[model samples]
Target: MLKIQDLNAFYGKSHVLRGVNMTVERGEVVSLLGRNGVGRSTLCKAVMGLVAPVGHVEFDGKTISGMAPHDIAHAGIGYVPEDRAIFPGLSVLQNLELGMKKKGQTGEKWTLEKVYEWFPRLKEREHTPAEVLSGGEQQMLSMFRALMGDPQCILVDEPTEGLAPKVVADVAAILQQMAKDGLAVLLVEQKLSIALDIADRIYIMGEGEIVFEGTPEDLRNNPEIRKEWLEV
Candidate 1:
C-alpha cells in the first residue's frame, strides 16, 4: 500500500529522480531494476524521506513526502539501505532490542524471536558485537532490525550487493517470505535473475523514469528493453 506520483529528487544542483511514478500493493513484491546511475537507489531514499523530494509519497492513503525519516518509519515503512548501518559496539541482541518501536509493544507480527528464527546465525551471534559479523550477517542484521519495527512496507535497496551465491539465495528467500506474510516489498536491485525470480511486478527504470512495467515473463521475453536499458 504505497504510491508515488510525479516524484522528483535532487542532489545539490543536479536532478536525480524525475517524475517517477510507481505503486506497491499489499502482499506484493515490486522490483525496480536498472543499471547504475539511473536513480533507483535515490528513489528508495526519496520514498523513505532520507532525501529531499517533491511531489507525493503516499502510504496507505496518507502523504509522507515531507515527514521526517523517523516519522515515516513510525507510519509503518521500513528501509534497509545498501550499506548495512549496524552499531559496531552494540551486541546483536542489543541492536535488535533497539529496533523495536517501543519497549514491549504488542500486536506487531515481527519480534526478536521471530527474526532470530528467520536467521539462526543471528541467534547464534546474539551477544556478539555487530562489527565482528560478516557482510552477509550484517545484511541480515540490518533487515531483521528493520523488521523489528513491524512495517507494512519495506524499501530494500540492493539486498544482494556483494555476497556468496548461497547467501544471495537466503536473502531472496527472505524477501519472498516477506511478501507471503503480506508485507509490501519495494526492492531496488541490479541482479536481473533474482529480481525476476521474486518480484510479482517488475518496473524497469531509466534516467529517473520508468521505461517498462510488466511481469517477470514479459521482461524475460523483451530482449530490446533488456539490451537497451538493462544490459551493460
Candidate 2:
C-alpha cells in the first residue's frame, strides 16, 4: 500500500506537483490519467524520491519522503519510468539478473522462471542483447525487471506509450495479473480506454493537481470531467 499527502514537487523555480493526494491499496490498480505536462510523471518521481518532495510519502504506514531512491526501492517500491530504462549493452537475462535485490536470492512471488512464463519472448531472447529487442519487448523487459525485485507496490509511468494495440493489450493483462498477485499498482497512463478497463479507481490530474477521483463507471458517466481534463 502507498499513500501520498499534500505532495508538492519543483523543478528549480517551476513547481510541478501541487498539493497532490493519492493512495494505492494492495491488490488494487489505481490509474492516474492526464495529458502531457500535467505532472503525472513528476508524481511518480516524487514518490520514488528522484524529485525533491515537500510532503509525506508513506509506504505501508512508514514515511519515506526524504529517503534515497535505493532505500525507497529496498523498502518495497519499484519504478518503471516512461523511457523504458534498460541496459542496452546487457543480455536480456543479465538485465533481469541485475534487478535482484541480492544476488541468487529468489523472491517468494516473482522469479526468473515465472517472468519467462508470463512472457515467452523474453525467454526466447534470453541471450540476446536488450538493444536488439523491439520497443514493446523492451517495455516488457523493463517492467519484468522491476518485478524481479519483488516489490509490494510498483509505479508504472507510461508503460503502454508508443506500443501497438496488441502490445498495449498485453501490457494491460500484465498489470491486471500483477494486481491479482497482490502488488499495488499505480499506473500513470495517457490511454483512457486501457486505464478505464483495468483500474479499480481513477484520478485525473490537470495543472499539477488532481481534478477528479472516482471509479471507472463514475468517470464514464462524467462527460464534463472527461472533456475538461482528459480528452485531447
Candidate closest to the true structure, highest TM-score:
2
The ten-residue window of minimal lDDT in model 2 covers: 99-108
Instruction: Please provide TM-scores, in order, for all candidate models, with all chains considered together.
Output: 0.97, 0.99
Off by over 4 Å in 2: none
Residues 121-225 of candidate 1 have per-residue lDDT tens digits of: 999999999999999999999988888888899999898999889999999999998898899999999999998899999999999899999999999999999
- Best model per lDDT: 2
lDDT of each: 0.91, 0.96
RMSD of each: 1.0, 0.6
Clashes of each: 0, 0
Error of 1 at 59 (Å): 0.4
Model 2 error, position 71 (Å): 0.2
